[model samples]
Target: MKSRRFMQPLTSPIHFHTAMIEQTPVAVFLGQEMIGSGKIVQITDYIVKIGNEFYVRDACTFKYAV
Candidate 1:
């Protein structure tokens, strides 16, 4: 006799991204206006730093491709 195993189609990271995008609509609210919308990279209890990996990807996108 042998035991069976199951594999999940969606991984944890996928679920996390789905939740982040669906549950919370990203936006910066200013009075009655919405300013911005984007993905969240990091979060903290007391404080958080703001930034994006655009610079990093820009540096590597075609550095050695050409």
Candidate 2:
């Protein structure tokens, strides 16, 4: 049997960078499915704040500049 160890994010969210600014509306995706769209307000190491909610980068599938 193999032992499983807990792992954390490779990098800190503080280092995350976003080329866009707050309120820059963008489409959200989860794989081929379009989840929805929201104005980008914040960017963390792993998550993005859209409108007033936050979403994980790994979850979103696609984003189109709008």
Candidate 3:
């Protein structure tokens, strides 16, 4: 006899764009001022805007190396 495995939908790592992989709503904040509305700009980047300030995905700090 063979066993069957179940598949899941709406999993993580949702495709953000063609030929690219990105996860949405990874980072979010409230009552913070930024420029531009929150949007996914790149597979691994995002453009966030709050109140009157803007922030790019490059604001994150690095801690691990490949």
Candidate 4:
């Protein structure tokens, strides 16, 4: 018989990078609500998503900026 182990996420919500359009509001969903109705801002920050599961990077490993 073989055994396997499953890893868990460090956080409940996951964040990712987003792009900004010209004179357009950012479109994203939080739970069931939509964010950014009529605000135009630079897309320098990352987009966060909530999920049941997530993955965490190792501390010993080096992370590259995408």
Candidate 5:
């Protein structure tokens, strides 16, 4: 007998523009690993401030966090 695996639905990346507008807490992930979590405090053209750390807006992925 063969085993079947379930696949998850694909989701879109959370853009900085949307995040800035929503102003919600997010989990910061580099690839599949979560590096940090915090609420967005500020945003610039190429950077985002989450808590006390600044990350290049495009270098990491952001997802809504509890």
Candidate 6:
């Protein structure tokens, strides 16, 4: 019989960076599904404000709209 081992997940804060400016159109995604699309209104260290909705910085993915 083989034994299984599980490793603890890292709890350190993640640093996110973006070059997109405010008012730029973007598509927000959680996992692989697109959740919303809007222009970026504000950005902070922990979250991003898009069209009155705030999403966690590390929890969602952003794709710039052309």
- Candidate 3 weakest lDDT stretch, 10 residues: 2-11
The TM-scores, one per candidate, come to 0.29, 0.57, 0.22, 0.26, 0.63, 0.64
> Mind giving the per-residue lDDT tens digits that candidate 5 earns over 1-66?
321211221134345456556665677777888787777777776767888998775787766663
- Which of the two, 4 or 6, has more lDDT? 6
Which residue window of length 10 is worst by lDDT in model 6? 2-11
Question: Candidate 2: misplaced stretches above 4 Å?
Answer: 1-19
Off-target runs (Cα >4 Å) in candidate 6 are 1-22
Which has the higher lDDT value, candidate number 1 or candidate number 2? Answer: 2
Candidate 3, residues 15-64: lDDT per residue as tens digits?
A: 22411222222233233422233234443345333334444435531111
Report the Cα lDDT for candidate 6. 0.59
Candidate 3 deviant stretches above 4 angstroms = 1-45, 61-66
Clashing pairs in 3: 34-50, 34-53, 34-54, 35-49, 35-53, 35-54
- Candidate 4 has an lDDT of 0.24
Candidates in order: C-alpha RMSD to true structure: 16.7, 11.8, 12.1, 14.7, 8.0, 11.6
lDDT of the candidates, in the order given: 0.30, 0.53, 0.30, 0.24, 0.63, 0.59
- Which structure among the candidates has the greatest lDDT? 5
Ranking by lDDT, best first?
5, 6, 2, 3, 1, 4
Q: Residue 5: error of model 2 in Å?
A: 41
Q: What is the lDDT of residue 7 in candidate 1?
A: 18
The model with the greater lDDT, 2 or 5, is 5
- For 8-46, candidate 1 gives per-residue lDDT tens digits of 111234432553455432333334443333443543332
* Cα error, candidate 4, residue 29 (Å): 2.1
lDDT of 6 by residue, 1-66 (tens): 321211221123321223244344667788888787777667777777778999887898776553
Give the clashing residue pairs of candidate 6, or none.
none
